[model samples]
Target: MGVLLVGGLMACAPAVSGPSQAALAAPRVALEAGHPERLRLVVMGDQGTGTETQWQVARAMAAVCAAQGCDLGAALGDNFYPAGPREVTSPLFRERFEVPYGPLGIPFIMVPGNHDESWLWGGDGASPRGAEVQVAYSRVNPQWVMPARQYQASVSGLLDLFVVDTAPLAAYLPSVRPQERPGGPWDAAQRAWLAQAVNQSAARWRLVLGHHPLYSNGKHGDAGAYDHLPFTFQRGGAVQALYAVACGQADLLLSGHDHALQLFAPQPDCPGTWTAVSGAAGEVGGERRGRRPAAFEVYGQPGFLWLEITPQTLTLWAYVVGEGGAVTGTEIARLSKGS
Candidate 1:
């Protein structure tokens, strides 16, 4: 394990209801090269449970941002659970999303997760159009931004974040003959947009975000059932999307679906782009390791990622939250021009 442990925390933002004060005293990790000169982003995924655990992580995020400062906060899809809300004004909106994260006070950039798109898959799914509702929310809430299903957010001079919809990438969609379905055309459009975005981005750092992990080590690892379900470009499946478009261009691809936190370096087959799974913000799930060892893996722990990007270095800190809102283990990774 290349993980490092730290002791002592610089008091987090005012304590919340859950996690005791003692448990919230864990060390707060900071970058060694100092704070980011360009952008600071906090990324979390699969965190829409609206449980105390979710609130705990959100509290930690608020504290960390308050202490270190953050420009934006992003959700790796799955903003809701079971099924999406019935309408833009659905009570679930305020309960699951607004209540917990509203205190952060930063614009939240989001993409729809598989659960958010559950309606598309089956029964009574029409009530809440998770994807559509999120976009509509952006109109009223300044902090919530998911302007389009497939869109890009540029952090000015530093990077471009291409947020994509990956629910359709599941093998099930086309299995039902999508050409005749509503999702068929949209799926094709998404693929085309992804390929073009990766090629056209001229930013110093190009990061692509989707709800599904291109590669993962938890329940949905490379050896998972969807492993061979190829995307438009790759013969095998979703992971190939990164190689097809992000080969020598994109710097990082972030996703959350596995309910675990993982970091994978570029492998021989998929070179140049680094993939990370930050899905443990609210859920603490099991892991199936050794199938494909991640550069770093942390499960049975709910946490989030702090990404500090500068011109010279891109540093990521995987902060694990324990009992209260304290950050326990902080796994750090730094990437530069060349390996």
Candidate 2:
């Protein structure tokens, strides 16, 4: 099937699975989309199969999102672990998701992860294919939705985020390759669109959120995940584009596929300052047996990322939720506005 984006207005490409005797229902909102003024949003990611951890992570972030009175929440990727198992609209999503995040009652905008697609693509149509998965997700969980393979969200117009799917980071490969794939107008369209959005908006920050990592010291190897065969997260100058987004003086960018957390300041190599890898939503471990990176200030823990913003300053934190639903991991970063 073709990429079916339901919220036609937004870049929502949901994988569509045909006819389900039972499916999650999506609440039809007017065919309208706009960014409100001075809004607060919650961003989290990589809450894989860690039933306990994902739950704790959701509860904590939900509280913050609710308390902050934010209308949107973000998730990075690999949402469900061990390769999605094809049957996406299962209790796994509803029970694990609709049940917990529903209380927040806000629109949860998300991107696809290697896990989100799962075994569906590996000859598992009965399990639910691409856009169909999205359709199912929307059907089962109205409070949540995926804006196509790529989409855009303007944070009060002050910030415009281009969310892209890096799953194909390394183009489509039968062997679960390492790098990202060459995408459609998604990345290019996003960059060109960003140039226009930034010039048009009176807002101070322009950020990008996705499931992959550009600058990371975590489990994944270097900047490029070519693996000597194929795949390049650097496709279409992906990394350059990411940095360009910041070089253009965009405030910050956030992502969550690494299972750990990271923060970057204005360094010589990068002028505009960047921070990301905040997933830790629920899983305490990563794709490779919970190994902690030597360079990571905090690693191998269960936590979530939080962002508190205002006209004057922006504060970001990492909360490590521990045993008995306990949270111990916390890191804060304060950013200043560019003149």
Candidate 3:
């Protein structure tokens, strides 16, 4: 339930990926105002398989956590591949788990990923299901935390985060057959639950998170991956879950299915709210096995996002993580909220 969160410092000098095409596209969106910042939150996703770079970044972030007074870490999902944490106590867990963020030791909470659930809950009890998986994960990892499947969580009073699972929505397509779905987040009960959660959260910031991204100019877009299956399904409303925050109650939405990073804002008719795809956490290097459109302005780097929240402004920093867990290329842009 509660974790004491171990804190430490970070090593600087990360692997230089490249310049963000997003910055090259149009001018960088300047912040409304800059000033005294309050909370500094780090966002990392798609690190389930574990990489030397990712592990190094986590180690580095641990130090920033202490200096910035970071209370927790939000793990976007796919925390473990080929299966979630079913083999919680395995040696791979040590190399992949304990070694990576063991330095940070903060309460790291996660949403589900296609890879995580495939191993943990879905794929039949033969894989890892019921209390067995839960017991293994919770009992073994002292720093790990995940809400009930399809649930919302409160972060520091200012934000209420609705963590959604999109697997079901995508699987519902005719290709997959609704009844044939092994598992997915697109459930009727979850829909009702999310609606109620939004209405109840009066926080200044409402964010919905998941593993699959809703908007991105990454390799996952266009041609093949453009299937963006979930976005077009059930009318745009299914993909529109990312837009729940567009109403203004929500400010930021995050995901990481594409294995790349892209920051999005009001493009054409898509108004309100900002979405980010933080899929590149030292895995595929931003190159999804899919084709992305030329119009897509991508960050084109191997790194993660850092969200810095202050009493006045909320800033998102895209940092490039190095092999040793250090992050550089600190670029800060604020999220504007007017009174």
Candidate 4:
């Protein structure tokens, strides 16, 4: 497996309870240049159920990594169902995450989904400390790499990953009261940081990883009008505005809120960036809700995304896992820009 040089961006103002500034400034390791830079990673989301299905997906991911070699994993979000861990020592961390994914033996770059930040059923609200607890766990587990709620990581000079927390930015969930949100001016700081980072990044590819999708063919639909409601348009407007920075500047926007796997062609709003939703890692959801069309859609089955990035091209594969962890990969997608 190739080395991933992960570092946090310090350009944004820090959150009150996140990692220290010193930790965010940690030095990055340079990749050797004798060979062309190549990186392989798996991206999955909504997978913290600790059920047989989750284990099946984990086994499938392990099999693929064992066969093709994955250097890193990106856990899109909703790591735990219903609510997130109460503390770093919560058994769910071991059973749902560590134990199931141990065989892969790679660090997961993570973001917090609505379920991970919720305090009750139906994922209607956020918990004040749920996201913070997960951030603290990063200090304990090397394989779980969420250094802060939002940070930028450079991966071997091939990809610059901007990981953002969308729990506070989303609008469909009505139960999340203002008091339960993150303290300080988190929303504005994150947007400023991402805009500057994406515009200034010199990496071969710039990708944004978050919990919510700017565009989706699944249940949640798109941001600004989530769930196809006009009322939500006003509440969810922030989400659209936040991601507008990456519309044409970033290479890809990867997210998972709806429980399906989908790949959408670049829409007029975000003409330069492709959108992918891989939320079926644990429980599968229904088919597309008809809000929009997808270039590819997979549901009623567990699946994930595999990406192979080189200096010349960014190739992607969508993998579907069947009963007994039978793995099948198909429908390759590639993106290239003259270097």
Per-residue lDDT of model 1, residues 1-339, tens digit only: 122111111111211122222331111112111222467789999898888888899888877888777777789988877666657888888898888887776666687776776655531122225676776776666566676666776654467777876664553343233431223555555566667767876767888888777677676665224434454321125434423566557788888878888898987756888889899887778866536657888888889999878887888988889875778647468988632
TM per candidate comes to 0.79, 0.71, 0.70, 0.86
Model 2, 82-103: lDDT tens per residue?
Answer: 5553455466676656676767
Candidate 3 lDDT by residue in tens digits, 1-339: 232323221211111122242321111111111122354567787776665656556665665666665545677765665555555466655766567766665545456665554523431112213213533464456455442445555544555667666544432232233432322333444555566667667766667777666665655452123444453542224444444433444566778766766676644434566677776664545443433332223344557777767555777777676554555755545676776
Which residue runs does candidate 2 get wrong by more than 4 Å?
1-38, 63-70, 85-89, 119-132, 139-142, 171-202, 225-249, 267-269, 286-296, 329-331
lDDT of each: 0.67, 0.54, 0.52, 0.74
Candidate 1 regions exceeding 4 Å error are 1-36, 120-128, 171-177, 180-185, 227-239, 329-331
Superior by TM-score: candidate 2 or candidate 4 = 4
TM-score of 2: 0.71
lDDT of 3 at 170: 39
Q: By TM-score, who's the top model here?
A: 4
In candidate 3, position 3 carries an lDDT of: 23
Error of 4 at 258 (Å): 0.9
Clashes of each: 3, 27, 8, 0
TM-score of 3: 0.70
- Candidate 4 residue-wise lDDT, 1-339, digit = tens: 234332221111111233454433222212222233777879999998888888888888888888887877899988998788888999999988888986576667778887777765635435536777897897677677776777776655677788887777663444345632333245666777788878988889989998888887777778876776655422456677778988999988999888888888789988988889889998687776755767788878898999988888888899998866778898657888885
Candidate whose lDDT is highest:
4
Candidate number that wins on lDDT, 1 or 2: 1
